[model samples]
Target chain A: MQVHELRLPLRAEDIRKLKEGDKVLLSGIIYTARDQAHKKLIELIEKGVDLPFKLRETAIFYCGPSPKAEGKVCGAIGPTTSSRMDGLTLPLLQQGLKVIIGKGERSAECERQIREHGAVYLTAIGGISAVLARTIVSCETYLWEELGAEAVYRMELDRLPCYVGIVGD
Target chain B: MRYLKAEDIQKALTQAICQISYESDPKAVERMRTAHEQSNHELERDVLGAILENNELAAIDNIPLCQDTGCTVIIAEMGRELVIEGATLQEIADRAAAEAQGKCPLRASISYDPLFRRKNSGNNSPAIVHIRQVEGKRLKLKIAQKGGGAENMSFLMMLSPATPLEKIKEQIVQRIVESGSRACPPLVVGIGIGGNFERCALLAKEALFEELGRKHPDEHYAALEQEILSMINKCGKGAQGMGGGLTALAVHVLHEACHIASLPIAVNLQCHAHRHVDIEL
Candidate 1:
């Protein structure tokens, strides 16, 4: 029942400093991606293409948000199932993507990769989209806009509440 | 029997889609509230409280509950003797979904091809419709906006007929506990047993629409539901796997007769804000 207060834009080292059951208010830029984006990112890796953004020291949020309402920051932001991104963790980590935030457990292989890369996984409350969305400051589609909700969105957040769930255990 | 028009179906589907997006079923809300009150872990309790509050905010704001508005599922129970005068039921359902997606401004989650083009269906159309005939003069429509977080966590076990009920409960509970925060804990566990592999899976999904915390009329199955609910809660998977008292608010089982050699079991896990509505017309 113990609780802790934490802040972000957190680093890989920051995440490693924490353990399981740490409550944090995350702020900064969280990129949104889902199954389609994961597939595309993996495909690009296969094709040996360069990524648009750096992955290291950055938190990759597993989310496919709704289109932002007029003059609003974001709409109904919530985490997607993280397990679906299991296959791409190693490749993404190899590319320096450090903090992985999503819901659910990591695959055995993903756990190994996370430990090796010194990464952390956070589970946000699912179905609490509106509450989650309130933390955002601005939103804009970055890539794969055609993918609709699956499109990669660059979101600026302000004290977005999240908790570290699984830390390689 | 009232011959419902396509427009009526369309309007109903649209309204239902929006209604369920943010609002939790009263039944589910009540169960979650009770479970949260009884929970032990503070983290799990917090998550449960947040979800319950989210439901209220969404209802007031009319916002989509989760970003993943989810694939639309429409279950229609028709009177055996009733007949529609205009379009086919399936067509109307699809049209309604498409119209709702556009007008409600719901996200377009459907894909044109699962493996190929993977293009957005654009309007969240072509809902998964299951129709059944019953001895009634009224038509019933039940709609649920199922989220992918929990949908992906669902599992099916094709057990040997010799598999004991204990083993069945073990598998279901293990998966649900292991699922933890992934499927959005403080969940509603829907179990479908006895049918063939596919039928059993469908039944599991179908069982999700049932009123939360309510048991089957059959005395035996009702006890099984309680047993499963008790076991899952004892795991301490809690609300969001943060460790709490009640991991699941309810465990609903829907079964059917199966082959003598097989005992197929399907587990359909639903998140805390289980949104669904039914109307009889």
Candidate 2:
């Protein structure tokens, strides 16, 4: 249960160091995606198309933020349930994705994949979007704008709070 | 007889939506604060503390409480003696929902179609409005912005009359345990017993509108609520399901007469970010 400050594009060493229940303050760039974006990402993988961003050593946060209010860099941003993305987890991990952040427990198979791939699953407090948004310094839609809040966002975070829910055995 | 203009209802709803989205109900906040104070585990206390802090930031910054902004659920109790001046209530609600999208930082969570199209409704219109007529000349509206995560975990069961109360308790606890961290505990559990299938579900949802920490009117039901709350907390799901002693903040039960030989139950869970508002006219 150590508290670690981690930067994104996480190294395999960083992933291995995390244990379940450890607190983390994540910083740097993280990609955002939800169920819809996962579906599309999977489709692109199946078609042998290159993704918009590199998956290796990168972290993806499962979230769909509310619309930004006046002068705010981002709107309320919080984690959605991770189980909803279980079906897409293995494929993403196999692509060398290293960190997954969301709320709730993942499937047994997803946990196994995390261990096998040397990845980690972190959880943000569900429903605490406003607090989470304060940590986001900037956000830009990188893809799938038509999906609105479900679009893939390239976010710059500073000390975004989370916990290590699942770590590679 | 009193006459309330339909436009007034629309304006009131718009204001209510913004208020509920930006600031959590004070009673719900106090209950969470109490849960924080009662938690023995360090992680549980930290989690509960974060929830309270998040709510405060939302109020100060004037932002939607959560990213899921939720589907607007409006329950209206209209007095029979009150006459609506202009538009239909449904139309007024829709207009208000659209106005909310324009004025607030709310996400457009509702889909235009549930099936093939699966398109976002854009403005978050077409609120789920439930209207009932009452005796007085005043109109009361209770608005809840129901997040998708917790709403997805709601459950319903039909048990035989011969089934013991213990069985019902077991089912309730089992459902909450299975829901785990997904429904976002420390939660408020709403239990509806006795109504038919659909009615039971509605009763369960309606029960969620009850003020946190308020007991059921019936002494028996109040005792049952306490028992169920204890049972759920014992599951060790804790805050954010990270293993703690405060999984549930409260359990509310609303029961009605049921058909012979049938006992129906519905469980609706609300997340820690209980965003709801009430308006009276």
Q: Identify the leading candidate in terms of TM-score.
A: 2
Q: Please state the CAPRI-style docking class of candidate 1.
A: medium
* CAPRI band for model 2: high
lDDT of 2 by residue, A1-169 (tens): 5799998878878878887889999998889999899999999999999887888846899998888888989988999999999888988887889888999998998888888888888999988888898899998888999998888999999999999988885
Candidate that would win on DockQ: 2
Cα lDDT, model 2, residue B33? 87
Tens digits of per-residue lDDT, candidate 1, A1-169, equal 3344444445545666677777767777768778889889878888989888777745788988876555556777888878888887788888877677787777888888887777777777778877877777888899988888888888887777678766643
Decoy 2 TM-score against native: 0.98
Cα lDDT of all candidates, in order?
0.79, 0.88
Q: Flag clash pairs in model 2.
A: none
Clash pairs for candidate 1: A56-A96, B21-B65
